[model samples]
Target chain A: MLEGISYTDTKKLTAIIKERFNLDFSNYAMSSFRHRVSVAISKFNLVSADSLIEKLLNDSYMFDLFLKEVSIYTTEMFRDPSAWKYISETVLPKLASQNEKINIWLPECTSGEDIYTIAIILKELGLTQKSNITASFISNSLMTSFSQGYEIKKMELNKSNYLRFNEKNDFSEYYSISNYKAFMNSDLLKNVSIEKFLIAPMINPTMVNLIIYRNKLIFFNSILQFDVLTMLTNSLECGGFLFIGAKENIINPEMRKHYKVISEHERIYKRISKN
Target chain B: MKNKIILIGGSAGSFSVVTQILTELPKNFRIPIVLCLHRLKHVRSGFAEALSLKSSNPVIEPYDKDRIEEGKIYIAPANYHLYIEAHKHFALSTEDSINHSRPSIDVTFVSTASVYKENVIAIILSGANNDGAYGIKRVKDLGGITIVQNPEECQVSTMPVSSIRIMKPDFILSSTEIIKYLIDINNKAFFGK
Candidate 1:
C-alpha cells in the first residue's frame, strides 16, 4: 500500500494493514518504520517496496516477515545485574508490603527474558504464589517461542551478571545447568503467562503494579513514544513502578510530571499517586 | 577546521589523543565536532563526563534528534549508532552493532560524509581496530578532506594505518601537528587569508 520516497508510502501501508488484518501500526514512528522496511527489503531480496507490496497483497504470510523485522527480540538472564539487584533489594520488598497480589506486566516482551527474571526473583523472595505476571507479544510465534523456554546459551554472561547483582545466594541454585546450557526449572516460571497484546492507548485503574518495558522505546518515533508512554502510565496503578533501559537516558519533561524518580541511575520511576 | 564540521573517529587507544585535542582547542573555536568511539555496552557513565572535565568545549552525549550546536563536542552514547541529517539533527540507531560495535565509527563517518560532502573535515586517529578504515575512504570519495594520525607517532597504529592503506589522506599529522593544523585552518577561515 505504501508508495515510494515519502510518508505517503507508510501511511498507505498502515491503512492496508488496518483494513485487512484489523491491526494498527499507524502510531509507529515514521523513521523507525522506514528503517525496518528498508531492512526487510534487503532481507527479502526484493528490488523495491512495490514488489514487496505485491507479494503481501498476493500472500498474507508476508505479514510474518514484517512483524519479525520491526520488533527487536533479545533474551538474557539478569541482563543488567545492578538494576536487578536494586529491584530485588529495594523494589520487591516495597511491592510485597503494598499488596498481597503483585500483578506485573512486561509490555512487548520479545523473548520473555525480563519476565522470567522477575519470576525467578519472586521465587527467591518467597512470593512466587503471590505474584501474577502477564507478558505481552504482538505475534503468536513469539508467545509460543517464549512459553517453550530457552536453553541458556550464554551461561557465563548470566552468572557474571548475577554474581555482580547479588552474591547472597548462589546463582546456579535457581536453575539446572547441563554441559553448557541452563535449563530453568518450570516450577520457578509457573506464575508467568505470555499474552498476545498490541501496545495501544487505554486506561486501567489499579490493573498492574509494575511494568518493565526496557529498551523497546528506542525503536519507535517520538510521537509513538509519547503515545505508548501515556498508555503505560494510564494502565499502571498509582504507586506502581516502571523500568526503562539504560540507553533510554533522557526523560522528557512531559513524562516527568507523571512519575517520581526511584533511582535515576537505574532508570526506575514510581507512578505518581494523583489522589 | 575549515569552516566545516569536524568529524573524528577513534577506538581503543585514541582516547588520550582526543582528550588532548579537545583540551587544546580554545572555547572560542566554533566548528561543531562529533566523536564516534567504540565503547562497552554496559558503561553508561563516565566517558562524557571525563571528556567534559578536560575539554574547553563542553562534551555531551546527545539525545535522538538533538540539534547540532557549534563549539561543543558530541559523542555517541553507548549501544547506539549515531548519524547526522542534512537538517543538522542527530539520529541514532539501535540495530545490531556492525564491526562488533555499536557507536560504530564507520557508520557515523559514512552518514557525515554524505551530509557534509566537501565541507566535512574528517580525522581518523589512533585505534587498535579497523573500524574507521572504510570511513576515511568514504570521506575521501565525497571530496571531504581526510586526515590520519601518523602511524609512526601512534599509540596503537592499526586504525590509522588501515585507513592510510585504503586511500591517501590529505594529511598524516602527529597529535601536536594536528592541533597546529586545526588552529591554522581556524585562523585562515576567520581572517580570510
Candidate 2:
C-alpha cells in the first residue's frame, strides 16, 4: 500500500522541528511535505520518521540535507519557453526605458535555473549593466552551489527550450562546457546577490521591478499561498511585474485586486498602485 | 457515504471511454469525479475544454489548493502531479514525474486513497503502462471500492492486465456496464436506496 509514513508522524516531526530549529512548518501543505518525508526516509536508508527525527535532533547536517530533499528543484532552464520569450520581447524593454536600474527578485531560487534564464535575458537586452538581481535560496548550501554555476544535465530539453524561447538565439553562447558540466559565464551573475530565503525576513521591504516566484507556491496550503502572494505583492513596485507558474492561479478575490493581468494565460501580472 | 469521491485513471487509449462516461452521467450527479489521464507536457490548455463539450458536469483543470466541488470534473493539469488533500482540496506538485508521467495516475490514485480511504471509488482504465496498478491495489487494501475495465474491451489491455496481476479488483466491467453501475449508484443516492 506504500503507507510509508502517517499524517500523525508529520505533526510530530513538524512540532519537534519547530521546538528545536524554530522553523515553522505549521502552514506548509501536509500532503507534499509528508511525501517528501517519505522520500527522505528511503533516500537516507532510515527505518522510519523516528530515526529521521533522531538524526535531526542530534546532527545539524542532516537537517540541511532534509531541507534540501524536501525542497523541490525539478525546474529546467526557460521552462515555459514562451513566457521567457514574452519577457525578453515585451517586459524587459519597457522596464529598461522607465527605470535607471531595474531590480529583480527570484524567490525560491532552488537550482538557479530561473536566475540564469533571467540573467541571459538581461544580457541580451543590454540591461545587465542596468539591472540588479536578488536571488534567494532555500538553504545557504544551495546558495554556494548555485553560485559555482548550473550543471547541465538533460541538455537536450534545456537546449530545445532555449531554441524554442528564441530561434534566432544561439544556445551555446550563454555558457561554456568544462569537465562535462555547463558553467554559466561569470559575467551574467556579476550583479546577482544570493541569500538564504527562510533565514531572511519573509517580506522584503525592498521593492523590485520584477519578481519571478514560479512553480514553488504549489507546495503551500491556500492560506500560506495567500500570505506569500501578499508579501510578493508588497515587494513589487507600483507597476512591477509578477510571474508564477503557468498552471497556478491566485484564488483569493481580495488578492486579485493587487495586480492587473499582463497575460492571463501565462500567469503574468503587473502590480496596481494601492488605492 | 457523505464524503465519497470517484477517481478515474487512464493513459494511452482511455479518452473516448471517459468522454462517453461523462456524457452519460446526469447533471445532478453529486459526487466529484477526478480524472488523472496522461497528457502531453507542452500542451497546457484545451483538454478540459474538449472534455466539457459533451459532459453534463463542468470540467475544470483546478489550481493548486482549489476546493473540490460536487458535480464538477477535475482534470489534472499538464506537467504537475495532482494530490487530493485531507480537507477535500487539490494539491498540485512540480516534483519529478513518477512512472515517467507527470499528472501520473499512481500519484493521484494513491493520494486520493490515502485521504478518502474507504470512501474512494477508484477505477483503472485502458492504458499502455502499469502506472495505475499499484494505486488500484492501494485502494483495495484500504477497503475502497476498486474497478478495472475488462482488459478485453480496452484499446490497450496492458494497464488492466497489470492491475489484475497485482490485486483482485471488485469488478472487471465493460464500458457500458461501468456507466450503468455509476448511474445506478447515483440513482440510489438520489432515492436514498
Candidate 3:
C-alpha cells in the first residue's frame, strides 16, 4: 500500500493509461497528473497506483470515471470578465465586419460555460445568424452533460462575472429556472456543432477565424503544448484571433512569431503569419 | 547548498514579514526564492507589483511552464495552484482549491520538497489557517530543513503553532532572526566557506 503516487509510478501509470484508453497523458505536466492519480487512488478506495493500473486494464467503465476524475472542468461563465469584455467590445465586432461567416472553435470543451458565453454574446451582438460555432469534447458523457445546461450551483459566481463583463444586459435572461436549476436557453446552442475531438495532431484543419482555447494548455508539458499550439495555429486562418488563459503564452520561439499580441493583459493574440 | 531553493509559505498576516525579508536581502543573494502566499483570487494584477516595490531583486509571477531561475522571487499567481517541475520549470493548475486556497501553500511546499529533497529550505510564517503545517511536516520528512515563525512574534500564532504541534521544526525564529539566518547563509555561499 502506497501513501501516494511517486514520480516513477506516475510514468508507469501514464503509459498503462495510454495503451489501455488510447489517450496520451504522458505529455501532461507530471506533477499535476501525479497529484490527480493519487486523488483517483484514494477516491476509488484503491491501495496503490499499481492497483489503479490493474483496474484500468480490466475495466472499460473504470476508464470513463477516471477520465472525468483527472480531467479539469474548472470553468465559470464569464470567469475572466476582462477577456469576455474585450471580445464583446472589440474582437467580435472586427470579425463580424470582415468575414461573411465568422468561424469560432472551442476545442476540448470541458465545461459548457465558454459555449454559452460565446452564444449569448453572439446573439446580443446580432451576429449569431452569421456565426459558425464548433464546440468539441473528448467524451460523449461530457457532451450529454453540457446539453443538460450549466449547473445552478455556480449561478452566483456566473451572475457576478456577467455583471462585471457587461452590466447593460440582465444575466438571468440567458437561462431559464426550473427545479432550482438554470437551464440555458436552447436557442443559444441551436447553431453549435457538437462533436468528439481529441487533443492531438490534426488531420483535417477546420481553419477557424477565432479560437477560445483558454487555460487548457497549462496541463500539457512543453512538447505537447508546442504540438497542440501548432494544431491550433493550423486550424486558425491567418489574421484570425486566438485567446488563451491569462497565465498561458506561446512559449515556443518558433510558434511565438505566428501570433501577435492584441491584448497583453487579456492574453488575446492575432495569428499574423501563415508559416 | 548553492543549488538549493528557498520556499516560504504563509497566509494571513504574512505580508509585512515577507516585505521585511525582501527588503533586507542583498541584491546578489544567490538562491532562488519561491513564495506561496494566500491572496484575493479575483484581484490578480497587483500582488507581485506590491512585493516588487521594496524587494532587492525582481519579484515575478511567472507564467505557466516558465523556467525558474536564481536570485529572483517567484510568486504563485491568483486562482491557480503552482507546482515546481523536476526540470526546474513552473506548472500551474486550475484544480479545485485545497485548504480553501488555490495557490495552496501545501501544494508548492510538497512539490518543491519532493523535487529538491534535502536541498529545499522550507519555512512557515504567520497565518490563520493550518494550511502549511502538513507541508512543513512533509519537508522535514523529506530531509529538507524546516523552520517556523516563533509563535510569540507572530501576528497570528495559529499557523506556526499548528506546525509545531505536528513535528519538531529545526528552528523557531522571530522574523528578525529569520532575516539574520538567511543573510548568514548568503554570506557562506558568497565566501565559499
Best by lDDT: 3
Predicted candidate 3 versus true structure: per-residue lDDT over A5-87, tens digit per residue: 88689889888777766788898988888888889888999988899889988887999999888889856788788888899
The TM-scores of all predictions, comma-separated, are 0.86, 0.94, 0.95
Worst 10 residues of 2 chain A by lDDT: A1-10
What's model 3's lDDT at A97?
A: 93
Total colliding residue pairs, candidate 1? 1
Worst 10 residues of 1 chain A by lDDT: A1-10
RMSD values for the candidates in order, in angstroms, are 3.8, 2.0, 1.9
Candidate 2 CAPRI assessment class = medium
lDDT of 2 at A179: 88
lDDT of 1 at A75: 48
- The reply for model 1, stretches above 4 Å from the true place, is A1-36, A175-182, A202-206, A249-252, A273-275, B1-4, B85-87, B91-93, B114-118, B184-193
lDDT measured at residue B8 in model 2 versus the true structure, 0 to 100: 95
Please, what are the lDDT tens digits per residue for candidate 2 over residues B4-123? Answer: 788999988899999999998888888889999999877777899999999989999998888998778899998899988888899898888888888888888888898889988899
Chain B vs. true chain B: TM-score for each candidate? 0.95, 0.98, 0.97
Which candidate gets the maximum TM-score versus the true structure?
Answer: 3
